[model samples]
Target chain A: MARINSAAQLEKVRKDIVLKKDPNKPCIAICGGIGCLGGREDLIRAFEKEIKKQKLEGKVDVRVTGCHGFCAQGPNIVIYPEEICYTKVKPEDAQQIISETVVGKTIVDRLVYIDPNTGEKAVHQSEIPFYKKQVRNILGMNPKIDPKSIDDYLAIGGYSSLAKALLEMKPQEVLEEVKKANLRGRGGGGFPAGLKWETARNAPAELKYVICNGHEGEPGAYMDRAIFQGNPHLIIEGLIIGGYAIGAKQGFIYTRHDMPRLRENIDIALEAAREHGFIGNDILGSGFDFDIEVHLDVGIFVSGEASALMRSIEGKAPEPRPKYTRTAVKGIWERPSNLNNVETWANVPQIIGKGADWYLGIGSEGSKGTKMISLSGNIVNSGVVEVPFGTSLKEIVYDIGGGIPNGKKLKAIHFGAAMGGSLPAELIDTPLDFDVMSKLGAAIGAGGLFVMDEDTSMVEMNRFFLEFLADESCGKCVPCREGIRQMLRILTRMSMGKGKEGDIEALEELCEVGSLASLCALGKTTSSPIYSSLRYFRNEYEASIEDKGCTV
Target chain B: MSDILLTIDGKEVRAKEGMTVLNAAQSSGIFIPTLCHHEKLEPYGGCRICTVEVESRGRTNYVASCLYPVEKNLVVRTRSEKIDKIRKVLIELLLAHAPDSPQLLEMAKEYGAKSVRFGKEPSFCVLCGLCVRYCAEVKKKNAIAFVDQGPKREINFIPEIASKECWNCKECFPLCPTSYLQAAYVLTQGLVGFKNS
Candidate 1:
């Protein structure tokens, strides 16, 4: 339990930890992510009990890991060395799994994912269509590492970026490398992370701060929980590296209050990092000292907005202020605070560990490297997907998501929640680039991609988003609060077949006020769904108005 | 403070650094409508009535004149086709709440805001936060603040404090853009007067 004094010592520790573990040993890693853990909390216990009953103690490891990302096939377990992935596993199957698969080393055909059309069984996790196409640089270790154990992270080269940033690279050099990579922020805006770092680093401040926006409150998005809960040290490592680059001595992780497990995992990871000297004073013999504190969000959608998130950190109400003064220059007690989403922070290690050129080689123009999108809503494979930028919507919808369920025709793809827009099925050929999607009017806000089937009413879908925005709006700004209410009322009446004349024009005017004048991004993009829906599905609005009754 | 030269409605104006566009415009006798702004309180950017088309760093965006700081070479158009349209809608939306506020009606007259376009759902409180901001920023009494959010958002006086402090000082009452604040304060008073006895 000695502190890692130097980079060499850290490397030696990693080697020693790697040497102690057997790579070929039988390990049963379960998907303990929130969505997959539907009464399967005792799956770990069941496996351990079955392993003991078979007297296979010490031979078999029953490790409860974070999300495997194939959540539609819930209660998933992967038996390792063979990388055998089993889905929809029951507690009763634990006995057979230990006796047959662990002892006999045979595949469990009944539990393995079968290609629905072909009926061909996919044995390994990598072989499955969902995992085959995904670039799992961030979440690839989810099935291997135990989140509670820092050694699990270290064994797989976790804190090496922090070590390299501290010992090898200068703070300015590290900042330059991130800038060179053009690592865009994954937290909604896709602002260049390095530019933000340079500002925070150069801003005159005796004290500054860096924050990880773990408040993934964007409706159906759960990628933050997937990777963060899977490997807490990944974000911790990235945050420390960011802290070193940004010249900040302190960091804060502002996450959701509703998810206790996500916060608990982050807490355990921080304590482990502190004990190992990866976070505390003079990390890895480098004179630079930085530490992070975890803070719970106010549990609202706007609380995830950068300004409001900082206000909550300052123990104030999570209402957003205008960003005329960027949070990077003035934030959190008026100190320069650089805040990036958890996914953005998670990508920092890869950029730093590998060269900027190597990181830059992964994705398309303007956007560099992979993006973790939380795929949900009428899709066959409802899970977390990490794909490189420029991956076509068709690829994601069909290859990764396994297409729409129940032979339903694809209606539209809604990216982001409430504050984002919807794309019709015809635009499935579009790339997942920052500029391309925003140009199409559908922003990749927090990477929540909801697939709507033919049965899905575009009007009802848009109404749902507006209702959510109306409910979640902080009501500080008149344009956002009153605008959303008025728009929602018109849409509500339209849905119930009471659409009056000029309702469309009234909604459009309110939308203009929302986008043009509202104080923050939440207000600025409040009309996104409305605008996008009205653009593509104006006929749906007219249909509802023309005595079609409630289309939903 | 040093002077920052900027163009307001095509007129060159010298404003002190750290001064807002609203302050700069008002000093130059330019008319920019605002509802939630107060000289004594902090810039709350809530009303969006003072929103102007500001061109900075080759990008033009709509920002509240009350909150956006004056920068060098900033082009401020207090009145533009888009800015006027946005203000008209913002006024119309606020009118849905406080349809009869003298302050809103005056701006509506200027902007030609049509309130009948939107359905009537009068909660009366425009959520300008003037009364709340006045109580907290000016009085430092923390007597009243906004409670709840979105459509349900309202200015509520803390019964414990308003019962004692408000009887002597009804300072925030005059700051309310609508009579809703007085109605809210009266309701809180009745509740508190009953509780105290």
Candidate 2:
């Protein structure tokens, strides 16, 4: 195992690790994301026992990876090389995963993920309509290995990416490659990765830092937490790589304290990285000293903002400052710092391992790489799914999400958490890329894709968003403070059909003012959901105002 | 830190980096109505009441100042006729939803919310991200969060089937505007105590 330092070395290591058939051995990867932890716990053990019973323990490897993203297909089991995905697997089906797929190299027709609309049994994850068009850059590692086993990741050439980066490419080159990939921050705001790194690199402070925003505050979103839990090391690796690239000696992962499991696993993974010399004051022995510390959240939604989050990390109350410097130039104790979300960091090793050209080849123009989405709410198969950028909302809900449960019709789709906008039933066919969603008045926020059914009330929906905004507005500014108070009142009135003749017009006006007067991203993006709702579902507001009641 | 001068509602004020437009107004003794906006939780930008008119780069744009970062040469309008009208409607809606609560009713009246046009119905937590954000940010114990999607979304106490993830710290209850938290606590406490008794 040679310590790799650069892309040239990575290219060589990749060739050396190109997967080929052992013929005598087979591999199985299971879904270890929290969504599957409970129901699939026993099944995983059963799978282990069945493998042993069949005397294939040494020859066949069974590992668990993080969220496969298609949570609806939980108790997910995928066979290697062939990429055959078995969905809704129960304890009874464990034998089939081991015997049929492991031994005979055959697909289990009944256990395969079935497309609800086409009624087709999806065997290979790629062939499945939900996955076929997906690029899966951020979530690429989920399907290939288990989160619990480093060796499973190793066998699939996981650390090889890091090894190559350390041994072959220079830090500057690695950053440039990432820039060429055109990777944007997938944690809601599409900030460029290279720009942050360059700013940090050139900043005037000596104690530079890199922070991982694992504080997934969006409603109905869990991509960051799932990735952190599923493949803690991958993120750690990315963090270390980011630290090295930006010349930072320290890094921090700001995760909510509520997710004890994620915190615990990340600690364990950090220890593992330290043991491997991947973290803690040195390289594979390259003398590039970089380390990471976990900072549990102190309970402020707005604190996820770079400056506010930095304030909390310093053991201060999480509060916002209006004229704060960029986190890249003056963050984390007023030093030059770079912040990327869990998903952003996860893509580093891959880009460094495989050339930037290879990474750039996937995804639509401007938005490259795969996005892991937690598809939940109202949908029949509420699960996690990782797809390439540009996949449509219809494909995610129908093809991967298995449509709404009980045969309910979809009313609208909400993207980018609570602050994001909702699309009407007519736009269900819309593609779910960054540009497309922004044009539709929605954004791919934090990777939480929640489906809504016909029973959902749009007025209530907008009001719900308002309620979140009002409480989380930090009260540092009048527009956000007073504006949210007023908006919440109006939305509540509208939802209850107490809206006056000018209520809708009033709301539209407030939407404008709130957008203009607010002081941070929280206020700036507040009207996003409201405007989105108004754009698609004006009738709901009209009903609340004109009809003096909710239609639903 | 260097300070930049900006005007909010014709009041020229100086602010530092990391301060929001809302903070500048409040410091200047200008009060704005708010609902879900809490100082402790992360900004959700879910509510639109905190909106204002911002003139920047020779153009005017509407933004929520709570979540928006203030910049140099930015002019902000905290209140306008358009903003007030919307605020009144929002109050009316809150009154209708939680008509039983005197607090909401008074706010509605202040905003000139006349009446709820429809019959009253049962209510829940106002869907403010307080509990959810608190669980994630303050307690660092995100046992409960906003679960489900769309208008029917709720503050789920442990998504994908309930578990003991909730320490029942009662942090979310105090922050809930609609008293849904109080109701849930009472019901849950009663059920548990009854079983034990």
The interface root mean square deviation of candidate 1 comes to: 0.9
Model 2 Cα lDDT, one tens digit per residue, A15-96: 5445543634567788777545766678778888998898887888777677876665576778876777887788888787
Residue-wise lDDT of candidate 1 within A421-486, one digit each (tens)? Answer: 899999999999999999899989889999999898877777788888877999888888888888
For candidate 2, lDDT tens digit of each residue in B1-197? 89978888887888888788777777788776566678877665555567677888898766666766768878888777766665665555445456665656666676676556323434444555667677688888766655443233445554321234444466566776767654366346544654565
Candidate 2 lDDT at A361 equals 78
Indicate the DockQ of the complex predicted as candidate 2.
0.08
After superposing candidate 2 on the true structure, give the runs of residues whose Cα lies further than 4 Å from its correct spot. Answer: A1-23, A49-60, A79-84, A95-110, A113-122, A160-170, A402-409, A428-430, A468-478, A546-549, B1-197
Worst 10 residues of 1 chain A by lDDT: A543-552
- Fnat for model 2 comes to 0.09
Best by DockQ: 1
Deviation in Å, model 1, residue A38 alpha carbon: 5.8
Residue-by-residue lDDT tens digits, candidate 1, B77-108: 98889999988888887787777889888888
List clash counts for every candidate, in order: 0, 108
